[model samples]
Target: MPASPDRLPLALYRAAQVRALDARLIAAGTPGFELMQRAAQAAWRALRRRWPQAGELCVLAGRGNNAGDGYLIALLAQRAGWRVRVLAVGDPAQLVGDAARAHAEARAGRVRIEPWSECAPLSGVLVDALLGTGLSGPVREPFAQAIRLINASGLPVLAVDIPSGLCADSGRVLGEAVRAELTVTFVGLKLGLFSLDGPDRCGALRFADLQGAAPLPAGEPPAAWRLAGERLPTLAARPRNVHKGQLGHALVVGGDTGFGGAALLAAESALRGGAGLVSLATREEHVAAALARRPEVMARGVRSANQIQELAATADVLVLGPGCGQGAWARSLLGGLGALDKPQVWDADALNLLAAGALAAPRGRWLATPHPGEAARLLGCSTAEVQADRAAAALELARCLNAVVVLKGLGSLIASPDGTLHLCDHGHPAMAGAGLGDVLAGLLGALLAQGLEPEAAARLGVWLHARAGERLGGAGRGLAAADLIEDIRHLLEEHSPCLN
Candidate 1:
């Protein structure tokens, strides 16, 4: 099958930044009203494409320009000989400037307009042009009720700009938000649309720059970038005479007692991820099982932290903390690696130990992968707080830990200590299984062992891991973590070929 076109832009902005872009456009040449008209036209086109058979449109309008887009879309539907009605959720009389003009145009165009009430009947397609990105707090009173009505209507809803009651800076839902089947956003893409709860509420998203043939206005740098296929870092093709020693060795440490499988999974992934030599130093009990499962991996039985310290001296990178318990054994292993300067990828129990003050946070070129819960612990806050503003939490963790931090969850964020951030909007709900984090840590270790910088290795490893899950996620449920390893290897080759 042919590849899908890249509808999503890489550059993502905060709500304020997008508004600034709009102002710059107006300052340069385009009139505010013309821009509003263009937005409506674009939305109308998308709506028609999404539901061509639906001949009726019920528009819920507010007092802002977002509602103005609804009014213009109503006019477009009316002109097209389709039945249309504008439910004035925000008093139309309160509209001003270009919004007022839009309402007047709809009125002149003979579109039926009425005040929105709790008992208002809804039918056909619903256009949610309510709060947009102007929501400063939780949804209040009548608008909240209106959003509830729209969500309960069981009608196909198209949200203009952004869904109401969602924070444009963070993806947190503010009290209530309209659940739309399609969202047509304009000017610039907002970062919130791809983070946290934004993906669930926004549904299918479509972006229109509205600049048309005009060059994109350079306002401010992007807040963060979306990791995609284009402009990715690639591994150089190997030389014909290269030997096994040329590639780096990666050591996997963890898996105490009952948790033996976790460390083995990491080691298996490291070998698959192209590490020249992979070693697993775990509890003596797991060595036989590890060798049985994967003979290629050099599995060693280690009883204490001293054993791992010896292994670390020859390893290029260490993939630490998968199934590493919080007992004294786990503590000893963590403490032993503290003085080592080897690059590392810390996940699972390693993070818990660090958060609990078991050892000072490791320095040097290292990467930390923490789920929202782990992130909250590291920040000394609640998980709810971390989820509320994930971008902020990730950056803060990166700064404090002095290492690249990967906040893994719905939208995985890779934040570098230098203040750079990247968001991976790939992966699927089916990937909500166990062992995925262990696989990711090992992949990062393999990439690091191959000589990529901490941040670059993290970015590439995350993309590869998530893309593998997405490819296999089509089977829906029962997605095992080990299933992603082979697919990741294949994808790595496709992205960065082995040979010229």
Candidate 2:
């Protein structure tokens, strides 16, 4: 696929939807057979480019047009003098329409077609052509066995469009889905390709518009947005005339007793992220430590809610629950602040509190950053349910909470109450260490205080957090939470809109 900026993004579709698209294209002018040939050529081009030295392609063929694409690819590879073989998982004689023609073409090109055997010589790249998007229930018998073999084969397997047995719309593996080394998709990008199990399954993605010698007409709008640095802009440089108050004050809430470090991290992140004033309302015990750590922050020892209410009253935004415990004390303080109508970000134990059914989402403009377990609590379901389809779960959280929901994970999904989705694919696994979510919540609160809309704030904050994590990747291991704020501040300067 040629890289182009104007191409339409992908939509998650069922096998039926893609078929409908193909039928529409055929009725519009192109023939069905021609489309099949185009899809085959596209897959072949991608395969060769990725595995330039590897030869002798073994295509796993099944029934339907997906199998037809495999056959055609085999023919194309043979023409290029690469030894190619097709192992039929289904009856080749039973194939009808365009697929039958493709099989005949492969035979003419001297491509060997044989019954699939567990002992078949595994060589070069394995092309998974067995199951196309029509799959519903878990993968059964033959296909399941085939998928297991493909995964264990250790060859660079290229899936035709979607990997066998993976749901095209949800990205869930039905029983099991082939983990492809590279996935070459045609027409629109699949929504499933960017979320849930999709990211891990679809290794490196490439797109091919077989119908377009140039570019296809802008198809249906993308089902979800793929957030990238190029699409989002950062904070503008302040004018010399600007004052501290004009920049916005952000309050860091929660640091009960032994957990003061979390609150201090949030305050420091807000300060580094451009909040005009950063206030830390934590336990009296940790006040001195916070002040000593970050002298710029207005760290205070709040014995009761009374002491912090004044700071909360004046705050432009509140970053709540970084290290909040679900104890009675934490609940009491949060209960008092719940109706303050401030643009607040709730994370960690605050999310757990909401999940425990103690506090509810506030009416104020808010951002809720929840990892899978916390999300499951708030939604009253198991974590596995949320991971099964992250896109839907995030959107549901946004609508139910009436706040921007940043469901944090591999491909962090930011969902708005209005149904807009932003997928963030940038982040390192080292970010899996503690306090990362706290850093994110603080960054989000900082953005809201700086005057971005809830959606914009959530989107850009996540990008900043992820980009910062990526920055730490070179250090190798032990990604401590406190290490990110300076890097995030640097990234903000690097990505600032006016600078660009």
Candidate 3:
């Protein structure tokens, strides 16, 4: 994900919303051509800052306002005494409205403009103005070839508004998309720029609300919100007289046979995440290890569903299915928990079992955290379908299960039963490993047990987990799952201090 500055807009809009806002700005007296000029200026400033020493420029121009921005940028470069060339990918004569006007301005300024050719030399910074947010279908012909050539050229690319051929709503690549080193977006923040393929294609994002567009009109709500520390819910300072019984007890149930560590990891995470008390119910063989590793948790060895009933009866929240296999033991544990009405955090094999129809979805306040593969299984779709529009998948999961859903991925999405969505743009690729999901499930359970609503708990837990992964991921690769627990605890205290 791009490094977000504190001043960037938090609301995420779809392509249509951004366009509507653009139209609104135009209606409010700012001419479309003027806005296009502002976009060009923004791109020019960002380009100069990023590549000040690169005096030569090459711009790939299309037929839309995006191309207009490119043309104006080329003119700006020419006026600045920098050698610049505009490669018109679309017919220059076919340019319409403000785009045509921009072409005329570039021509009047004696800016070098020529038809795109395969032999065009990609020099200095390459400006991608091929397609914009208006693109809806797969890229075709010369544009696709041009994007490929630019990518292959290994030049520092600056994209206008959004990278060409990327879906502005879904962040999906349309056949092919430009990979930009920096992207200068305009108006409202596009939803695609921070999710899915957006993060990979847009290296660093800079926003400029050209024309100083007013707040969105009534009834024009953002598609989702970017999760940030300032926007997240914080826990209140604890009372000095608080006792273990005052805070909720969290029970972690899993670890069938060979997967004892998964359950232990969850239990340990819950204990460290500020849960008043944490208890572990797993296979008998793992009890000694669990007790030795974390004596604070009341670890119990359970052999059957009947044995788990007593443990479940006393717990305030349940963290189920870390390393829980699809055998009889896992099924029995689910069945035992099914009779209770406590808040629950279900993950791993629990999600698998629910997808397989072996266990019913929980009826109480619950949060379901599933990766794309598991989400695909739960939704009865392919993983590609889930990744294509992760927000939709997450919303569907929340609606179907009537639970808060955390769709874990590059931009982790949290969907509420009310249809609201939030995206966590934190985390690092190095955190991709076994046991992270288990730790998240435990963290969610702890937050719930500490009295946060299901949605609040999911949001805070996901953010903490991803942010911790990002901090530890700086070391680059080989990040263990256990490495995140301490960071999460520390971050929680920092964000929601005990004495603040």
Candidate 4:
């Protein structure tokens, strides 16, 4: 969240592709060794800025250009009279091109380079330059041993480029990845760095445009663009003449007899997210408590389709299914609203009903907010399958359903029916609690009422929700659905929307 998503372009690159670009740069007049030196300087500068007083450098080196960067770092630290050691995991002589030159330079600078061992004392800041991004499959033998050692060392690590064992394309850890305190990536930003295991492995991220004056050839975007608060358009300040009706009425239809709390929360979130005249069409049972909780919301007790008709007809938006169970009553209620004309948000058991062929979305502009399990069921695939490539899965679902698909998970990818994909890279582990999806659905519904496009609403609302979760995630752990409403309002107000 520290870096705006817009700061990094939508383009992404694989390890081989970047490496090829590096070679092309060398071929295009920039000396390969000069690029290596520039990279080393960049890493060193970032390392110093991140940890100003940390004097020692424990550089983990492999036989590739990444290790070359580490070796050059060791040389710089050694020349600066700081304690520096190169824990070589592979044969340094096997290093070719600028990497070999770096190894020679490190040796020339009288820097200590020794064969790596698990027992090697890691006293200072660790530098992970071992596997790099070109690596795939399992981390074999020595490198694996080194990664295990680094993890056990519990040292604050500065990973060079992508983490040692992380895949730049998909972010699937290849066996294991270095847990870095700060990852300084170079040139083109790797899309995987912000998604999946990428987020967990990359602690504090910093990007450096190593290409300098040269620009590389463009390639197909990885899958989606990162969703940040900067991407949302500024909501004009409410007019002095603004009325509850003018802002757009959103009717929340859900909450069966037993699960009224879910419906209440959705209505509450809709109101908080700036929907004017938020109404709840729930069971007659929970009306009093919802009224007591937030009297601003019009709590309507509806038993049949006749009751929902007026609300649905008048409201600009409809948020369907929070605690709406897949029971006969829930189906009967939704079936009645099937022909109604309104921009809708379908979620939870409503998605389940869609999968079961019991419910059909009244098309125009709609959003479906589905967590992994719900998404799997909707796509007729296992959760693992949906997560393997979340970007692809989200895009497929959006295209098939002809609605904005918010496939929520670690990365929280949002895909539009027209093939635009955006990734919401915020949110914390604490958000894994129940009722969060319903909150997001309601938030998006409110955004729709506010007149943001369906895709923009999904992207902006999700980013705000995730930012709230992160802000509230303290060292104490665990978060409730209701815990985020205030933070959501604060973030929405402060989020300037348009990217600079």
Candidate 5:
């Protein structure tokens, strides 16, 4: 919660995994009730630090262990002399196991407990303890109504473990979900918290290993990992006598007719991203503009696929798509690309063409970067289906296309051909603009051309692009696609410097 660099959790788990870890801890030594108490203490500490001046506390509680943690938090608050009240959404009398014990303890501590109602007055910080990760179906009546009320309460909210009604496995909003300003999770980080609707609902995530349950056992790999500076691939410093040829050449193919700027952006980004030599093969009308804007790029106007073949033959890597219209010319160019034996980064209309079955899937090394809509089309599903389970969609895409897939969105997911997944939690809202994906495609191509494997290039490129967007997005709205080029170069140098 407090942006302490060292405290961030790197590994992420599914709801079932976290639950298993909890059970393991309890079985080893710690009691379930004791764990619940520790969770409460952790949440209380975070709540105090976040809203220290606020003396009143209102907790919305349900009937699971999640509600048990809420009851314990209420007890702690009351003991600390803070005004505390617990509105029980689930029948308190029916509470069992650790939850019942916790409720008894809250009553013993003189914490006011009352049944929840639509008319219940909400004041001060609201604590959501209504549901936990076990939820798999759509939120039911009263709980749904309570979550809606919580959202409309205009009160700062602190969620226990996870926000109520949000799927811990997929981060999907099941009919509805509570939007918490801050959430305190225990044991391990949930996969859902960083993707889909998770990032939006879980405002600021705080992890506390109450039982020191991390450093999980061997052979139990996480569903995915959060991309951080330490985990990033290094582009180690180049030698003094290095030649341009050693760095590898990158060819950017696209920019059909009116969409030439997209190809130009990718070429320029590739050059800035450390590609040794960048070449642009676009429509004749756009070649002059590409050369004028970025004279360093070897811009060539190609009227037919045969002309592009000549350029492709000399290139080490190809960055395909980016404003490539799905017209006759675009089809002709894509058809010619199948014969080339080069690593390719396909994006934009290229992805659309692939989805429409107009272009054959590349047999050689390739990486596909697709937004939700493009991903939906590629998988023969709807955008909502792709969004509902982004990880699944990305992995499926990678397998189906036999290429690394970068599913670009709020929390972009990079899925390797072998099914390994990584997530980038960087970037900002201002980055939701045109041409950014083109920039990313170019950057990915540059990284690949520079000798990084497709998987590594995708992971590193996504991180660099997102990090640059975050830096520029601080200036508020209107972050153009080209604005990230310079910043990305700087970030790349800092993260994977050309000189030590």
Candidate 6:
């Protein structure tokens, strides 16, 4: 059986890396054609299981091995007494090597093959084999139109290998992409399948290693790691004698005006996320509400950035910019923290301040939680550019800022300055409401306060926060940011018990 999405491997490779591994497998005795045949068989099995009642199959065949896999599937469906047709998008005559052989075999099996056109009618389970990872630039001409047709068909589309036109390395849609109901990918799990546009395009992912799950060669490390069970980095279980003092303190700064809820949420999240002590330094107006909301937090009202000095002196880790507005007061608060080399989680308007050049970037140990918009500002590019290749944007941001970065969005990515990247594909769309980023920032700060390294904290914090959101977001929309705080606290305990 192919690996289900939830049961996928932790290691994530780029398209080039997976290809290299495929070559290695071929060099180690498995023929390329045999691998293609296995891919087809895996895809066929998954399709039958997913859509058992659907007896008809339409294969959109390209010119590469992806097409070879589709042709073989068509033959299998025909043999199984199901009506099957192959739409040769890339001319079958242009097929080479293994693909050519597969085409000939399909023809010998009496499978109907016809040239593709925009007018072609699509039905049943549409198999997308039009483009694969080899796609270099924007999809052009007939292929793009074919992808559009597949998307508009309202059919149960099953993409072989990957959804056509989705970049195998970046999850970026190249002009157009197939919206597959189920995608059967082979060999290694591509990083793109779990980042950016990948989750939306490749629905219900299934992985087939094709008996090539051998260890990768040296000097070809995975592009990133997927945050999941067993492999997810976590904090150690607390000792029986552990005390609040040993748990560490986290200070949250922000809540300019009319945004007091953001600061309170962060403070509350920090307390619930296992920080022994959490402080909130915000505008005087918000302090009364902050105290009323979270009595345990040491909420203080400060007029100037200098007032934060005493509070910063006590915090082991700081969460900067939850509801911080882009005003002079916000600037002063950020500037005031520059002298202290505290581990910090920078989010919201704090990121804006850094991007706008209102203040110098914070030095020392800091982690950035930037949604695509903030990331674009930091990169000096448009949000579309950042979304186009989130993995690249995350790495660049980490490298440029000299800090761990959590590029928040669909598939939240955590990237470290040393090129280490991890992705959490656990979030929900219902988490679209405000203050979620603030909660994430607070959770990250709590992890940091508790002594996890910046990268480790980022990976664990993102995973926990996303998982909590996923659990609570099952009821659909209207998931408040405060809703995740208690769930995250419970999950943190479940992940690392307070007394183990």
RMSD of each: 2.2, 2.8, 1.9, 3.4, 1.9, 1.9
For candidate 4, lDDT tens digit of each residue in 1-500?
12464465554555666677677787789898888888888889989998889999999999998999999999988887789999999899799988999999999999999988878788799999897777768889889888888888888899999888887866778888888888888866776787789977978887776755555556434455676555565666776676777778888988998898898889989999989889998888889988999899899888776667877888899899999899886787787565566788998988999888898876678889898888899899998877666777888999989999998888788898888888777788888788888788889888889888888788788889998999998644668898888789988888743223
Cα lDDT for residue 210, candidate 5: 91
The whole-model lDDT of each prediction reads: 0.90, 0.83, 0.91, 0.83, 0.91, 0.89
| TM-score attained by model 3 | 0.97
Clashing pairs in 1: none
**CA RMSD (A), model 2:** 2.8
lDDT of 2 by residue, 407-475 (tens): 999879899998888777678878988888888888888888888888989888898999899989768
Give the Å error, residue 341, model 5: 2.2
In candidate 3, stretches whose alpha carbon ends up further than 4 angstroms from where it belongs are: 1-5
Candidate 5 TM-score versus the reference: 0.97
lDDT of 4 at 128: 92
Number of clashing residue pairs, candidate 5: 0
At residue 134, give the lDDT of candidate 5: 94
Candidate 5 ranges beyond 4 A from true positions? 1-6, 214-218
lDDT of model 4 at position 467? 88
Clashes of 1: 0
lDDT of 5 at 183: 96
Query: Poorest 10 consecutive residues of model 5 by lDDT?
Result: 1-10
Clashing pairs for predicted structure model 3, backbone only: none
For each candidate in turn, the TM-score is 0.97, 0.93, 0.97, 0.89, 0.97, 0.96
Model 3: lDDT equals: 0.91
